[model samples]
Target: MNPRRKKRLLFATVLIGGVAAVASLLLFALNSNLDLFYTPTEVVQGRNDGGAKPDVGQRIRVGGMVVEGSVERDPTSLKIAFQVADTGPAITVLYDGMLPDLFREGQGIVAQGTLVEPGVLEASEVLAKHDENYMPPEVAEAMGKEHKKMEYSEGQSGY
Candidate 1:
């Protein structure tokens, strides 16, 4: 083989390899930094931890019921605080942004952000009720169970 031809072939091979490497790197970085959605159960069950630190500025979505009487807002600072519950544990959320119109006490919400401190989540966005009579399946199911219990007790008393 001619020396010049050999040199050209080697350069072409290296250039192609370099391009492929760069593309792979970019994809990996993007995937690593992506924020993923998780329901309250998933979050508490460690399903969406992805081996990433839950409180180290990693973007995430946490869905749960908004605890009744836990919603509060500061008119001056526009800061909002609320409690999100999964029927197991509750997480406190702090956000400084306009909340969704459907946000209210005793409703379901999906907060997107990172944990700013232990047991305290700082949300960048807050997603509230999807529609009238619609709630997060988790919250609705929990409420249903509670309703049944109460009804059963009332029936027993009457009997």
Candidate 2:
């Protein structure tokens, strides 16, 4: 091949290779940081459309209404355990940190952490609705209360 043609081909090859390498690295970083969301029922069973459940040890965010009378705190430590449920089955979440003030039974919450067991999550962070007027639309809809707000005035559980 001519010298100029060889130079141009080499340059093009190097540029394409560099772009592909960068794209792969970006995708790897994104995938590692990705956290999938699932409902308690979806954790216990598969999705309604038969999607596979989150694998054990995978990072995820699960949101649901805190099951009434399900919060249990360890007297010796800051660790707390509670069951989060949607319309169907419930999944237990163990968190070892200060829970948000708004966190209470019958309230909606989202826990971000890893699935340590099939139906359990070891939460690294727990988030609760900041106000009565605010609820994550996704959580509300997943729990089968699309338009209704969570009410606990009569000592009832939102789930």
- The total number of steric clashes, by the backbone 3 Å criterion, in model 1 comes to 0
> What's the TM-score of every candidate structure?
0.70, 0.90
Tens digits of lDDT, candidate 2, 10-108: 999999999999999999999999998888999999888889999999999999889999999999999999999888889999999999999999888
lDDT of 1 by residue, 48-120 (tens): 4354335456678777788898888897998999988775667788999888888898777888898676457
Task: List candidate 2 segments past 4 Å from native.
Answer: 144-159
How many residue pairs clash in all the candidates, one count each?
A: 0, 0
Judging by TM-score against the true structure, name the best candidate: 2
Global lDDT scores for all candidate models: 0.74, 0.91
State the number of backbone clashes in model 2. 0
How far is 29's C-alpha from truth in model 1 (Å)?
Answer: 4.1
Which residue pairs in model 1 clash with each other? none
